[model samples]
Target chain A: MATAADITHIACVVYPGYDALDLAGALEPLTMLSSNVPFQFYVVGPSLEPVTTKVNASVVKTVSPSFGQSIAPTHTYDNPPEKIDFLIIPGGMMFLDPIERQQPTIDFVKKTYPKVKYVLSVCTGSVILAQAGILDGKRATSNKACWAWVMENCPNVNWVAKARWVVDGNVWTTSGVAAGMDGMFAWITQIYGEAAATVAANVIEYDRHTDASWDPFSDAWRTTDPDHGKSVQPKFTE
Target chain B: MATAADITHIACVVYPGYDALDLAGALEPLTMLSSNVPFQFYVVGPSLEPVTTKVNASVVKTVSPSFGQSIAPTHTYDNPPEKIDFLIIPGGMMFLDPIERQQPTIDFVKKTYPKVKYVLSVCTGSVILAQAGILDGKRATSNKACWAWVMENCPNVNWVAKARWVVDGNVWTTSGVAAGMDGMFAWITQIYGEAAATVAANVIEYDRHTDASWDPFSDAWRTTDPDHGKSVQPKFTE
Candidate 1:
């Protein structure tokens, strides 16, 4: 049994305009694993300040006085822990705006990926990892709703069209927001055992999709082959 | 189509030691309804301070800095908006510690429920509503893991065993944390028709369980009759 000494440190990267479900979907299941396996988590960002999501100001303003206040990072990218066992990145529509706008997040992922045991991305979060060259020569998937944009931006990645999640070596990528929960459940199964994963799912009453190849969205969205699409010129600035 | 003039204000009652997914699971689906229905949200609590969850502190402390920060509430119970269209209450293990411990939360729901169009509870959140007398004579459900405790505390309410969610008039209650997403999806369907709910579910990539009667967990957990069990004396103090 893993003890406190064997605790793994997992980092969840957050940013302004990130999807709240993308973060919560993954964290909820992962946190439930704590009772079985000793592990810790870190919400890392550019700074320790609060980051807002894209949930529209007027709707969330009453609850979150400023922007759509989502989460406040515990550690700045500049001062992360010396060792991180796992890293999770969540997605949002903001990534589709301008690739150059994600430089800070890109830089942080690039600097930290080598030190982590596993790197995971949810929805458009794969875009940041792709921009950092972390998903190069790796199998990955992103939010199917924005599949064309992801394929256009990161041509080097083996982007799977019909997949709930894709795992290549130490990298894990998932489709859309809620899919992250399924990916996290699968990841927990990989780390611990199926029993541990089942317990976690039961705790949250989540009917997890265990099969990575199971994705009905690709058919729903009619995602085409990456090669057949007219690729938008990569606009990411190093 | 609902315009800005027809916007509904939904207040999510939050507290310290609340379950993070209980809030997020419901909010994620409901927030997606905003673009279609023109609705707003408010995270109301005792104060505007950061509230933590049951997620192990060691895991989140590095990311949140203090008290394993989860979310910061927008409005206080003492000063909420003039009118609220809906109310949501999320549940956690803390509620099981002592029913009286949740006096403040119960009071808030009781005071605000009459003005809202609907009241929703996720996981053990049903306990709070039940304690508040909002669920009196109303059919409801709660987190299956804590089924016995919830049944014991809120015997006055008609508790259903096999249910993904229950809707008695305008009050909605769901079993467990992730079940809240299903409940919210159903609630959206009630407000804006199935088409709008489908769009919201598609956006989040959520395969919503539409049937309120579809609950497999009750069979798995071996839940018995709510009336069959010897009721524990209500511990909640007025």
Candidate 2:
């Protein structure tokens, strides 16, 4: 039973080189909820400067705070909502490598996860979550193309490779770019109840794909060489 | 040379039921072209009530010297550019049937086509063009899904069934929605030159699919389709 009050604050963190759809997919679903629930959400990026996507047609802007850096009640819908209930991180091609290595950003994710109700990632964003050490012994997933790489670098995490969306408790991740939309709906279903989420999906005409739930890493991995043992793990570039 | 002066004006005609992408695709390419050429374009619909898309997320304000009303080109960008270089119609799901039967609108298109230098349609926009009898006996194309319907209704027209774009003299039509972008570049190529169009395509990173031009109604039709005898005509119930 997710009420409008339950979603007091929502923030999408965007860094330089963020993918447009990675953020857009999540934003679209959130707006559907907003259109009905009347919750306040804004594009929060590194700065006020407008950022263009890699494709270059779409433009995204940032939100600013009028109050002190930290505001009230864990989560308020004011100019600067202090309490964050949901924090979404969208991955773009440019942010792929750097964000995984960004220590300060990792610390921020680590610090914020305990406070937020749900921590979400789209596309390569799961890599960032992995580097932050949040997925240790936790079931997680990432962009399918990068799953092999994730397994080698972040061994502590159990990766679900075959899912369009992998949800384990409060941590959720999605595959590729467009799959983020699926991930958002999955999030909405949990927060707003299935009926509300289904109606929202119908309004957008997006048919939820079947491969949308979480599974363990063993059955999820797909390797080309059957002769080669499953012992071969993913490798990191740096 | 398609010099800046050659394109004194551009017209993006909007109907009561128009798709946003068609207008956008045409506008973005034209805007990109404007960097090299100076031209102005405006949105003109049947009325001025702030037309909305089928999905209703975006709203486009309409302008006029209404279609049948007398035009004083000096007053607004609503009129086709000074030379009437380009007249574009974007397609939307609303354009599927009933709106296509509007007498005054069709009459305006019928009367106006020969007067313009280049007449173009994006997606189901060819429905309007066909209904106006502009496609009669002309070699053209439209969104792939609507090809049979256009052929059945606009009998005299020779439809190209499988092309992303088709150019027949000054008349051009595109398959599907995004193809309008390619069609615009093609139109610019005809007006300016291949070189400038190539540059514009490069700016957008448009990877034009270099497939064979598909003309299902031509002599090549006999070689490809043995069952060309079957005719599945589209019925537009207005």
Candidate 3:
């Protein structure tokens, strides 16, 4: 059992054009867990330089001319900590770009996944995990707005269309940006118990969606892709 | 009417021990508005040094012994831009501290409020606005968890308990951390129109609380202060 004294190190993977909310929403609840569970959060990127998001480009331009909010990473992929208990990856417009363009991030995820205790992805972050071949045979989900895109690109995973969050073994994936909070709260509940999760949510006054299956977004944003209902066989069925 | 060419510069006030969600939740939706409306966001702090939050102390300690996630502020209070169109203030645990302790931030609020066209506050951020004498004759709301503390401290403002967000002229205030998203969405609707607001919410897959009067948290965390019901007369009642 993890006690208050046992520190859990969570590495939040960030990159340029990443969705700020995907990382922020998940961090909000996770941060609230600090009082009961001693933990650390490291904003890891490809480098220690300031990273930009998809939003506030004009503001970000003033500071870095290239990045958005000027978030300085504590550690780079090359200099990550020896141990990472939790790995969180957030998605953004960059997710739609070619996989080769994000080779460094995908490589980091592949190298780090086996050592981490748990893996979590927000929005299209699952796409990155899929590209890394981690979610090969896992049941996962992605942002509802981009569900069809994921279904078309990753044909090796059993992607569920109706779920706020899908937890297959140690890997957890959420739907869209705000849904990351629900997934993080649910993940906390699994690790820290319902009481701890409840306390964390209460601190932020967040009415967390406790039900993993209660996702209304999948239907709200209907994907016309005929393959949307098709279940792709897992390549690594364990 | 504001066009895409009309830029709105938003100065987000941040500090050590600040609530990550208060600023993040608001920024998520506001940032989404950038594609349709040109806006710039500046993370302002006392200096360019990293600001710490209450959570993930161990991880934050690894990077900087003094702060949590290292947020590199683009501008300082002293070196702020000449024109700030919008002002955003977020709250955290240290909100209840003596006003004298945060004199610089309070002083900045007092000095900047008049120049900004819109002033938005999240959670106990209203306390800072109140302390700055900006909410003197205006209506506002804050995090229900710290409702009594705010009421006791800022007795000169007309504080509304049953509101997710309160809009008095150009100033907007939200209930808690997550509620800032709702407030930002509402603010967008007011400025950019319903279609724009809807697009922003849909992108995040966020089901925003559209009604300003739709807050149940105020009752859930009700305070027993006798002066809770007393509506303080606004000192700058227009």
Tens-place lDDT digits, model 1, residues B135-193: 88989998776677777778899988889999888789999899999999887777667
Off by over 4 Å in 2: A1-4, A55-80, A94-96, A99-104, A210-238, B1-238
DockQ-based class of model 1: acceptable
The sequence of per-residue lDDT tens digits that candidate 3 reaches over residues B35-139 is: 545566688888888776643333333222222465678889999977788889998765334556567888998999878788899988888899999999889
Ranking by TM-score: 1, 3, 2
Candidate 3, residues A1-238, lDDT tens digits: the string is 4333343788888887777778878987766666445566688899988777743343332222222465678899999977788899998865335556667888999999998878899999998899999999989999877676688789999998888899888899998899999999988777777887776665577777888888766666664334553532211101
lDDT tens string, model 2, B1-238? 2344565656656554454445545555455455445555544555533443333233311211110101111222234334455678766543244553345556666766776777788877777787887877777776543444455556777877666677777778876555676677767766677777655443332334333263332232231243443542221210
Q: Model 3 segments beyond 4 Å from truth?
A: A1-7, A55-67, A224-238, B1-7, B54-67, B96-98, B224-238
Q: Best DockQ goes to which candidate?
A: 1
In Å, what is the interface RMSD of model 1? 8.6
**What ordering of candidates by lDDT runs from best to worst?**
1, 3, 2
TM-score per candidate, in order?
0.88, 0.47, 0.86
Of models 2 and 3, which has the larger TM-score?
3
- lDDT, candidate 1, equals 0.75
Clashes of each: 2, 6, 2
> Candidate 1: how many backbone clashes?
2
Local distance difference test scores for all models: 0.75, 0.55, 0.75
